[model samples]
Target: MWNPHAYLAFADERGRPYFDLLSRVGADAPRRVADLGCGPGNLTATLAQRWPQARIEALDSSPEMVLAARDRGIDANVGDVGDWVPKPDTDVVISNATLHWVPDHPRLLIRWAEQLPARSWIAMQVPGNFDAPSHRTVGELARRDRWAERLRDFRFRESPVKGPLEYADLLADAGCAVDAWETTYVHVLTGEDPVLNWIAGTALRPVRSRLTRAEWEEFRTELIPLLDTAYPRRKDGMTFFPFRRIFVVAQVN
Candidate 1:
């Protein structure tokens, strides 16, 4: 179970990229919009502000997230994107900092594209930091140490962000107008192990979910040396973590 409280730690760092992705949406007067994997609905609420004329639906698979969203008076529901059936009326579908959790995301993209009406937009952003020092170090620890056997069933860390041309081609093949790009965000963090702290908020959820408290602690402990080596502490006690993410915006024809 992923804890929303734990994930909220890096809200500032993650929120910037989300806003950048949303800016790409550029919805002038979208009628109906849906936010996929809208955890806690903090970012989803912005869609309502951006397109005040649109009725927004916030969908997330986690009960906790759905409940939080509902408490905020947003039209929130618990539903898996894998099983979600987008309405034909959905004019804009915005998914930020999500999608990576779903396996077979390319298929989902095609399906969402097909579900929307002509000129309907789909804007999404996903972290592509699997190759970053933080992720690579943690992955090495998860696969190389004594706990490796226990974590064998866990999926290895994969880039949440797909290649630009790959995404463009997928949308084009699905008969949609596609614009896709990749960017590396230089996130400056204070204190020690900020990169590790950031991943613990986002990418670490999957690995942590499968392990016991003791095992999780052990894994983090073992991974520390690797993190420090990869992200050497600076004289100012801060670190600059370069995180890459994929952003895509498509309009169905």
Candidate 2:
């Protein structure tokens, strides 16, 4: 039920962290590259451009995203990223802003690090914004009134991506050389209720898909004002959305 258009509305802003994650990958030349959770494949296509000499492919669990990616001429498949296995000669595995959605990602990262061939590279980026005001209010609001019953179980959506040091240690234990860090992107968003528009593409989807049309609109009415206050507009009417993300690049050796 992922709306590609909604996800891509903040394409430029959403893309910056991916690019930052990509830039940190140490492999100068790779023979095979895979982008896990390569939503819409727009960024994955860039991987082909960056390493035209390499074989590149993208994987997303959403059929809609996979179809859109294939339509754009990128080799994309609809498959769970968590279930992916690296090809024997796979040189690099780079995932951008996607690992957070995979349940128990830290355990998955450890297993991938242990299994991938020595000297191969694994680079990943995941949003670390669970406690941020934008997301906190969702859980807060879900606990009240009519929302409490229909949306009672909705709060488990908080991403399980761990802190930078934890990933660093896991990769190190798996005999890889790891570089892990955190970055907080303060995105200045414009247009009407841009923050709503932003999360609607992502974090809002769980509630959106489950709620009836009337319930969704009623929820939006209550949520909008909270978002407005949580993320105040500047004089120029731009909302600053501070998002934190964790990045890990491990070269198994």
Best by TM-score: 2
lDDT for 223 in candidate 1 is 74
Give one digit per residue, the lDDT tens place, for model 1 in 19-132. 887777766898889999898877787877788988898899889888877877888988888888788678998888778888888899999887788888999888777777
Q: Can you tell me which runs of candidate 2 are displaced by over 4 Å?
A: 156-159
lDDT of 2: 0.86
- TM-scores across all candidates? 0.94, 0.96
- Residue 43's lDDT within candidate 1 is 79
User: How does each model score on lDDT?
Assistant: 0.81, 0.86
Pairs clashing within candidate 1: none
